[model samples]
Target: MKLSINQLRALEAVVRTGSFSAAAKELGISQPSVSNHLLALEKHYCAQLIHRNGRLAEPTELCSEVLSRIRSVLAMTREVEQILEGRKQLQTGTIRLGYSTYQFALPVISKFMEQYPDVNIEARAMASHDLMPLLQDGNFDVAFISAKSPPPEVNAFEMRIEQMVAVVGKEHPLAQFEMLQWKQLADLPLIQREKSSETRRVFEANAIKAGISLKTVLALGSWGSIVTSVQSGMGVGIAMAGEVTELDNLVAIPIDDNELTVSHFLICLPEMQHIASIQAIFDIASQ
Candidate 1:
């Protein structure tokens, strides 16, 4: 039986997203088109690929068996396209990169652009946790992250080290100090990032070493939320010193421990490390 790439993609998207409508939105096509692809695919194989489960679509047993192969085919297809494009050298191409922090990534990207003006760079700032899953899914070519460990699927090139700092409102009691000792933060209400944040993980590790349980009064999911909470006198916040910007009514004081530094890593799929465009970027970053 013969199957088209679009038909295979439609099946994968529908199975992954759990609904034809959701798959349509992801593929940037009409819902009817997604349905048509599936219809043709099933007719060609003379087998049902999907069955309705309430409002969602679940892949049949037959479809499930072939899903892995489909994903591999699509991945290789993209690789072939990249190889073909790489024949033109680094003069023209797109680098889709995700990042955990902008402070570090922006400068690197700025330098990269100056050297290769024709190359397109799409950079997005997202949480380190979110960036890794997307990278594993082939959504990003590379990522800039500050974390304790890189994911197993990707290789990391250590860039620089950064330390965490305690942030407080200008009028807060802790604001009087130039630098904060770890013990001082024990009793204070802390505005912390959610459990998934690398900043929080590093700060917590330090707090544990200081023999004090961190008193996290608020757990915010984003940096903006922590900033707002700290600014409004909700509690003190912790962040990497370089990552903190726009501190109008707040002060970011250094934490006492030197070991609280997080290492910034340039992460990408292991196989992609040798690509000319990606290597050029790594070379620039290494300089």
Candidate 2:
């Protein structure tokens, strides 16, 4: 018969406890069962693993030489079991997340963290243009991004459709208007997000279609920077609806064109959707 884990465990327990009856008690098996396992182990390996004298037992020299390795193997087995159990229970794991904007991603992230406080999260905010490639490269387990359509390689769940809007400082001349047309901003100094921004992309595309050449005075990398610049009265800023805070001394004016909108999606590689942490976050976002 081939060597088995039970045989190894019985041998180790007998050697450790110094008696067959004690080893049987520790292993939750009868003394005869422990003897049979040890006998089978010795017969298979052609080496006596233990020496017995009355109620006492001792490891033979050869068994002693390999005892440390056997203990290591059993320790590793227990660790593997614990890891699998933790994952199955959603008690431990890390999720790498990429986001274009926190406005949409943070709410879901907050809920996920609240529900699974033991799970670790690594969240990176980046330009919408950079999110897809990094997510595809396996740098992210999931991503929240703004796009006209989901890429073919990933699975996407539509979160919401956000409209592009003009953000002007409270004191700016155009802030008083309830809504504005794209052509109205053609002559104004527009402060925009970086060229990689999906908001900027949609706005420029719509402007081009409307036959308006915008005079963009500054291109900032972050939403805060655009808001700060606008607050300082640098120029009018462009942003997605619901992004500008009410207390920021800014007014978000809806643009007249419906085409100036983007769909936000929560996306992941199709195979990764089954991972517990990723699936948990997806469920939270879906709800």
- The CA lDDT of each predicted structure is 0.81, 0.84
Give the alpha carbon lDDT tens digit for every residue of 1-287 in model 2.
87678887888788777899998999999999999998888887888888888889998999888875665465444445546978555576677899988889999999999998877899999888888877754467799988888888788999998888899877888989998987798879999988887888888998999999999999988888988999999999998886777767789999899788988999987756656677888999999
Q: Pick the candidate with the highest lDDT.
A: 2
lDDT of 1 by residue, 57-76 (tens): 99999988777567667655
Candidate 2: list runs displaced more than 4 Å. Answer: 1-88
Compute the lDDT of residue 280 as modeled in candidate 2: 85
What is residue 163's positional error in candidate 2, in angstroms? 1.2
lDDT of 1 at 126: 74
Where is the poorest 10-residue window by lDDT in model 2? 71-80
Highest TM-score scorer: 1
TM, every model: 0.72, 0.70
RMSD for each of the candidates: 4.4, 16.1
